[model samples]
Target: MKKLTGVMAQALTIDEPVVLTGTAPHGILVCDGGSLDLRGGVDDRLTIEPGGYVLLSGSCQATVSIHEGGLLEVAGTLSGAVSRNDGELWAMSGSCIHGRTLSAAGFFIDLEADATPQEDAPRFRLTGTGHDLGIAD
Candidate 1:
């Protein structure tokens, strides 16, 4: 999938179900005023409207947040994993779901956590991986 920014699909509205197949790297899909039907895939950030929903599948590890005014009704399975510090995960006024929340560890979720603890939370530090990014973006 292509990398996008805020208000990319703001005006673009769809009534039918929208599906996304394959992998998406560092992408953000926001539905401010439409219905979005998500497919099984990986994404960095995915947001659906009040009546929208996301059906996730595969090892798609991402930070999901459901707007107070909006809604993110999710279902299905997530093959990927999510890990973050307790501080950062509970700092924002959003949801930081750890592990699958649908039915099992891979199932989707309907987060119900405090936003205060998640906002401005501490960042997660990463150790060495042996390889370095040759050129910084």
Candidate 2:
């Protein structure tokens, strides 16, 4: 597990697939349409602001927490959990997630109808404070 901390530049782009684990105390900022490929264990408390995109390819196990003004976009295959506190999440079509729990306090858009949780799948919760939470299919 690779541990990471501090702020990531807005222009940073990771083209290769890597496994990362740790906490971004100050959060992560990936702007200018930056993209990253992550695989393996990622247990981090961070924020991915707008224009930041992360691709979870292959088999990925992670627990990510996104703060306000953050966005989490998913592609490929992902397994584990994700929570957004007044942020946004776009789970793209053609993506398959197993053993995953998605909780949002803001916006959650599931591009694929199949993204709906199965009987045995993890729960998806929406709890927003004073804000009208939106969930789209």
TM-score top scorer:
2
- Name model 2 segments beyond 4 Å from true: 1-34, 39-51, 99-137
Whole-model alpha-carbon lDDT for candidate 1: 0.34
lDDT of 2 by residue, 1-137 (tens): 23333333332223232243322222333443454444332433333555555544333344454455545555545444555445665544344444332433223334444454333332232333223323453
Best by lDDT: 2
lDDT of 1 by residue, 9-93 (tens): 2233333455554445554354544445444344565444444444342334554544434433323333232222111111112
Return the TM-score for candidate 2, rounded to 2 decimals.
0.40
Worst 10 residues of 1 by lDDT: 128-137
Error of 2 at 39 (Å): 5.9
Error of 1 at 62 (Å): 1.1
Displacement of the residue 66 alpha carbon in candidate 1, Å: 1.0
Predicted structure 2: lDDT? 0.41
